[model samples]
Target: MTADATKRLCDVVLDETIGRATPDVEHERAVAIFDLLEENSFAPVGHDKGPYKLALSLVDSKLVFSITGEKGEPVATHILSLTPFRRIVKDYFMICESYYEAIRSSSPSQIEAIDMGRRGVHNEGSQTLKDRLEGKIDIDFDTARRLFTLVCVLHWRG
Candidate 1:
C-alpha cells in the first residue's frame, strides 16, 4: 500500500479466553501486531477517520473483529465465518510447517523454493480476507496479509 493510504493502529489485542497459544502462534501474533501498528490501512465502513484499536477473538465458531477509536470508543464490529477460509488457512499452516522443517536442514535453493510457496499461500489468504471483508472493512493488501496471519494464529486452536 502507498504511504498516503496507510492508517496506523493504536493497539491490537487478542482475547485471552482463546487459551494459550504455541510459541509459533505467539510469534505470528507478535509480528502482526507490531507490523500492523507500524503501518496499516483500517477504516471502518462509513467512518473515514482512524488511528484505530483492534481486538481479535473467536466467538462460538466465528471470527470477531472489534474496532474502536484511538480513545477506546466503539467503532464497528465484523464477524466472519471460518468456512470460506478453511482451505487456504489449512494450506498455509501445512506450508508453514514444511518451511520450518526445510529451513532446519534443506539446501539454500530448497529453502527459497519453500519460502516462495509459503508466500504464495500467504498472499492467497490475504486476498481471501480482503474479499470477505469487502464492504465491511477497507484494508490494503499489506494490511490484509498481516491480518490473515493473525487469523491463522487464532485458527490454530480450531
Candidate 2:
C-alpha cells in the first residue's frame, strides 16, 4: 500500500486548561501550529485517517493527543506519560535561555554555538516524541519537531 501524502494535520488546538501562556510561549505555539499545518505527514497506524485535527493537552502528568476527523468526529486519543521527556524538556528550556541571552550580549559565533546546542536538545526531544508515538501515530521528523514545540508550550509554567 502506498503512503497517503494527504494524511496530515489540518488543524491543531491546545487545551484551554493549560492556562494562559506568556507572550513568548504563545508566539512559539502559534509558529509551531502554523508550520505543522503548512506541511505534515501524520498517519495513524491501524487506522486510515487523513487531514486530522489534533487537540493536545496535559492531564495528570500524561500528555494527551485528542485527534479528530475533518468534521470534528472522534478519531483517536493517545495518552503518553511525561516521565521520559522531563529531563530533555528541562535541558531544552535551559539551552534556549542561554541562546536568548547570547543574542543580547554575546558575539555572533557565541550565539551560533548556543543555537546549535539548542537545536540538538530540540532534536533529542523530538526523537523521544517520535519514539513514544511509534505504534500510535506515524509522523515524519519535521512533524515530530513541531509537535515537540507544542509539547513544550504545554509544559510552560510562565
Span of 10 residues, lowest total lDDT, candidate 2: 1-10
Q: What is the lDDT of candidate 2?
A: 0.85
Which numbered prediction scores highest in lDDT against the true structure?
2
Candidate 2 structure quality by residue, lDDT tens digits, 1-158: 12564588888988875677789878877887887887788977876756788898778888788998888889899999999999999999899899988899999999999999999999999999999999999988988998888788777766
Clashing pairs in 2: none
lDDT values for all models? 0.83, 0.85
**Residue 39, model 1: Cα distance from true site in angstroms:** 1.2
Model 1: residues with Cα > 4 Å off, grouped in runs: 1-6
Spell out the clash pairs found in candidate 1.
none
Please report how far candidate 2 places residue 70 from its true position, in Å: 0.7
What TM-score does model 1 achieve against the real structure? Answer: 0.87
State how far residue 124 of model 2 sits from its true place (Å). Answer: 0.3
